[model samples]
Target: MSTPVQLYIYDLSNGLAGQLSLMLTGRQIDGIWHTSIVVFGKEIFYGQGIMITQPGKSHHGSPLRIVDMGETAIDEDTFNEYLSAMREQYTADKYHPLEFNCNSFTNDCMGFLTGGSIPPYVTSLPSDFLSTSFGQALQPQIDALFTGRPPSGAPARITPSAATPDPALAASILQSVTAQATMGGPGPSNGILSMPPAPPVAPAPVPPAPSLPAPDASLVSPMHITTNPASFHNLLSSHRAVVAFFTSATCAPCRMIEPVFGELAKSKSKPDGGVGFAQIDLSVGLGGALAAEYQVHVTPTFLFFLDGSKTHELKGVNAPELRTQVDLLIYEAFPPHAHMSLSLSALEAIPLDPILFSQIPNLDTMFTKLAGFIDGVTAWNGAVTQAQVKQTLTRTVLPFLKASTATSPAQPPMASFDHWPTLTSSLIANLQLSELFPLVDIWRIALLNASFSAWNATKKVQEGPLNRFMDKALQAGDVPRNYLLTVLRMLANAFSNQVLAREVILFTRERVTKLLVDALLHDDVTVKNAAASLGFNIAAYLQKQRIDKVKARDDSQSAEENEEWETEIIVAILNAVERETNSEVTVHRLVACLGLLLRLSPYTAQVTSLLEALDAQRVLKGKLEKGGCREGGVGKKDVRRLILEVADKLCPDMAMAM
Candidate 1:
């Protein structure tokens, strides 16, 4: 085993000194030292010290004297036991070596070092020597022992560095030695020293006590309430005005009112010292039962009590109203000498009526006029910019409708297309006399009319508006799904505004994609159509963009460029055709999108799982088509000519092959 390191000690406390004495001597001190040992409690503190031994003097009349061991372990059980014994055996009146030399010496030394008084020694000691002398002489020996190796055997004392004894310094030396021995000793005893047992330990500290809750003023008097229900009735009987506000954590409105209630409680005083406020959070245990008893359906219910009796109940109070109600309650309970009237005209300055749609009767007329304008542009083979359309819808259509509906008692014209004509007639008649008509609606009307003028020329005047009206009516949400589907089919067949047509198709596709993705796991046929529509539109758009890009490129390019361009063109056309006819396309829309990309741009084949999809549609379609009646087939000659025509329109380079 390694030699024990020496420890130096200084600045000894009386308790530490007594503890050290008990630890070293295996004996209890009496009176002062014993008291000191108990007073200092334990050695769980950090500090510094030195040790030295005197060559020719006895330490505290002990045959063997030891000094400090600067940083060394100690036998904790032996030390604790010894100190405990000293405390138990020593009396307050008797002065013995244990008390005088151990206890008094420890006390006085500590007092000198720590600037505190030495406690009186209660233990009897031998008559000639002063307590101070023993400490002073022992100091050097204590420092020396700590400076050198610690003692090897059980309860053995070792002196490290030798010092000449001065009577004045002897007391300090002895105290220092005691402190060192207590603080720095051999490791905790391994049952070697037989000493008295230690007392039972005190219980551990509990967590911090809960704080008292603040008073709540939202509850009305007469209602008995307490977070502790057993005491609730007692509290209510004592109070004249009692108010209970039931609240919860999740309620936003409840949280908002908490601070306001707290403020009210602080500002108001109880009349006859009988008013009381209580608030209960419904989130805690047993809160649900209490809530049920109070019939608290919603949060922040303020129940009022008058003279410990239930009075009025208020629900959902705003801050200002709550303050006013509380003030009124207070005034009623404790009336003032003067009465003051309050005027609320200033508070009522802002309008509070909700705007309803039926009030705007001309709204449908406005929409019709706008739709008419759109029709005119479509007829004229003209394009109406998105900005112009959105502006017309917001400024003209929405406002007119709001106004017309605002004046009517009947259900708003928006409910169905039946009232749209009445709304449209009013708008046209109003517009006919106004100059704003030419600047706004006319310009848009001219654009759309020009776009579709040739197609609608043979059609009658009333036919245009009637058709548009029918289309809008069909698209109305109140219409049955099958009827809406029929209308959509009719619109597709009748209209030739390819841009609008394409956009409508895209919109349908996106909606279908969402529905299909949500219900795909169910294996529904409706889901399949939706997925197919989405895939078809995506492939169509890809083909369109590819063709547009190709057509825009200059024809004065190299052969290699032309070949690459041809390949791209071929790929795009093939993808569109395949996507239109392929039943296997009924998978995830994203997968279908990836497949379209891969077919159009096969060079990206390294991207695995890009074209993978769960397609059961091919098998289903085969079964369906097999069961359908066979139709008349076109001759090869006519088919070849049709193919050639399609090739010429799409890829001129591939026309020869067809």
Candidate 2:
């Protein structure tokens, strides 16, 4: 008789991945899948190498779902021979979380047995994860774990009879029951093939642990009352570090330190910190049970839990001691990233704040420049309307700039200037590419006002005044150097306002990155410097988000979607760093940009690879050896110091070894 073959699908994530992957990865990943092939009344899977058990009776217990993989005519002896050959390729040490694992072996087996492949979702999962930014960022750590090391712990075993090893099998059965309770029964089953019963033997080795819940930053709140035992356990499980305050309703000491506790929660309550605070009143529901469980018999007692175990205790109303312990708890829970060990003082001093073009030009002279350009452009004959724009700038914008930019103790509020948007839009729409620079410079200063930038950012992407002007400049192609410099400076100023930073720079990063990359290669030194400033803004924004995500434990899509555009930007900066001979200022800014791109990047391997491919270390060493770069001048030491910092401190270990 032809034997039935089935694909047993187990969710190693226990269904949590389906619930959380969308929120965490910005993509809907159903599960961390593990699959095995069942044929000839035996279940086979690969983890610590190939292993077999009775059908649907492995340590995975019941599969999350099963698929009819069609029947295989291959006899038991031939199948066992195929398995023996497969074991050589799918050895314990050959396991990679992404590249080679259980699914890989099942797909191979399915191909041979039924001339079919594993479900595409099952097979494509790793590639899909590797495609995401978080995956790219985390690839280095994951790669390091499974690369060359021998698979540790228990080895694979074969169960010729219908049997499975103990405790592990029992636990797996319990887990399946729990999953069924929570997630409903297995996926639509096409009649499960039955096999002869056999005695349950010693338990199988423990399966790998599931991915944990992300330390919810929102949980880092003040010690709120948690009455239910299950809710309290969930709270502890959600955070890496937690503080529980035990108190009676009438305890005076608890009241004394209550404010202090609230303050501590407020101060240290950050998502990246992974610290949570809870209050348990001895007088209330389940509080007595929790107190008795942890052996807390006294009022106003504070218990600190680290990784779900009570590690320390304090019994007092002393605020200082409480503060000290909480600080220590947070420090222990979230250790600094390895990248923090580098000596990067020079690089650290490079300000991440936006470089603003806040220089207020002579309004009359600027207007004169614009009027002259307007008269010259045959395409723009709206001289009267253009004059009104100039009038509006002098009347409304000039005073706002003068007042807002003042150094007085109390500054006047920014005027509504409701007509400024209309006037600027009309001016931008009417002006030719050459005539746009003077008007753009005026708008650039206006962007320094929060109100103007807010209005600019909120407009439709294509309809924004800055967008319209930049589009014109991009379309014109061979623009004058002056226009490029002014436009670049305007972009730098856009970064000064958060709204513009998001909407203009970050939201339009593709177009802005392309423009900056091309401008970095411009022949004009001033334009290159301006482009470097804008590039610094982009890099700074990305790096800030990168660090914030690291600190907040945010695994969602980071600042840039993928490293392609960022790599393109970095390569352009590297080229700028290599080719520049005259200006150390340009070189300093370019090096800073490069440092920000590489520092704490999730793609350290990729960056190191790029640096090697471009021979960047040699180029930077050459810059260091250059006499002008080494020579004495204002901030020349900083220029040289930053170059060394980028080379010695920021380059990955692989690059350093090279």
Candidate 3:
């Protein structure tokens, strides 16, 4: 019962005993060998990250000796889970004859499974031997040998599991690695260092595969940090929270919390999850730099970081304390944006994070090309290049557009609004109307994701092109639908910035929204639909500002006027919907806009007037009676239900009467 774990070691290239010490250092150290960790259950789960074979099954006969890692409280399923993850991290492709080979696998496995390390001679032998002059001298040949065709003994390349393995989390295995392979135990007081296994006396018996457990449903599983200290910083990405557990070999409390820490890590690193977990053993080399920098004087010290900077620290094995801090840290990494009572939830809100430069390999190239197009003296052939510009805009801008604009937890390009001024200014200065129309779509997208200050930065420059574009449209007999669409979209997104929205509204005596609404009667269905969308965004923004002002109660007169203003805008919106009901191109978006208007809770008179003036009851009732908003009921979800719910919210009395 106590001996739940077994290690099988195989020696290659004769007994290591013959030449190990004689040519210990450098080039001469590359030793030929293999090892595997097997949990003694009803059926042993074969491990072949490096070809797990039984004692005498391999060409190398029985292992020199078997080491028991001790009894584990981990259940069969969780134990298997850890093994599966290890199988992912330690693969045949990663094998190095002198550095990380089969013995490294056994050491890591045993450490994770039992919090007990393998014999020093085993884990450290390759490193110690490699440092010797002989190891240095012979490393080239050894490297070439292992790199080409894996020796007949090595494990084959494993196909990684489709389900992403939780690297940060841990399962049943308790890993304990030390600078020296010395694990404090009664067995192997000195070293079980062996010469190449006595020339294949007999093959060991092959073990049966384990009845492995199904994968964990948790978002992300446990993590173990086995890489060098130099690479530790790169392991965690920006805009994420990481918890580092600095434990010394002597810490009892550290061992007790290992399982808890591992489990907590799993919960925090799930998909869309923001936290990371790392375990560091101070007894190992270079552990001092990390420990000293963080002043980690105590074992089991938990350091919490937000975007790589340490924000909180907890010492000792207080599970509750650690859990609370981790939760706080995660919230900090991906905090919810500030919202009024009407703000959308994570599921509902539109994402507005900018297309980050880091994510796109050709980001600079794209930026340069766009800038050149805008700055060029030549007028683009409207028909020829419109489609191309639209494609470019969609690619660059769509990433930034979300259902709602976020203020904080500021992270990434969305949070880095400081960079927008230079970018926006160039577009405003050089972009001609031909290219500018296409650019407006993404500019609106950018506004949806931008904070107030970010949007404010380019307002002045934007006004010039927009004004010139609008004047040109007003002078035309045949209105360019794209131009009108651009105007409306910009107005809608500008609402995110109250000051900018107000300036725009006041710029032409509030003609922008009204012009868009007026365009609902345009012959082109696309223009009509664009009008509806623009009306919705503008009305939604203005109504919210009015309500917020009323909520603050500056003056009752102003409050009443705000209500009247909201009613007027809603009436305009509802009127556009009424006129454009026959337009197939925009009715869906228009209907959705009405739903948003109702959600904004415009004045009661507006809803009633909308109903009365538009004879909406007949049209909407018929639509509702038919079971959905779409024709032929091809819709995936019930849009009619949503429209009714929003309508009912706006006018319960009217809804009940209908």
* Best by the lDDT measure: 2
lDDT of 3 at 102: 59
What digit string (tens of lDDT, one per residue) describes model 3 on residues 1-658? 3447776654554454345434333234333445566664321221223343333444344566666667665566655555554554555444454444556556555655565666656655654644443334334434443345445542222211223132111110001111011111112222222222211112222222222233232312335454224324643442267788887667899989988887886566633224657777765533555688778888989888877788888988899888888877765565431122333332123222211111112334544455566547465433325344435444434334422333342234444444344444445455655555545554554555446325554556335544544564565465557766666656555656556655665564345644764677687776676676665555455445545654443333332235544556656655554554344435555555565455434344555665655555444444443333344431424454544444444434444555
Rank by TM-score, descending? 2, 3, 1
Report how far off residue 206 is in candidate 1 (Å): 32
Worst window of 10 by summed lDDT in candidate 2: 155-164
lDDT ranking from best candidate downward: 2, 3, 1
Please give, for residues 93-181, the per-residue lDDT of candidate 2 as tens digits.
65655655777678667756665667778866765765554444344434444443324322123111112223234234323322221
The candidate with the higher TM-score, 1 or 2, is: 2
Q: Candidate 1 lDDT (Cα, whole model)?
A: 0.35
Count residue pairs with overlapping backbones in model 3.
42
**Deviation from native of the Cα of residue 339 in model 1, angstroms:** 13
- Per-model CA lDDT versus the true structure: 0.35, 0.68, 0.49
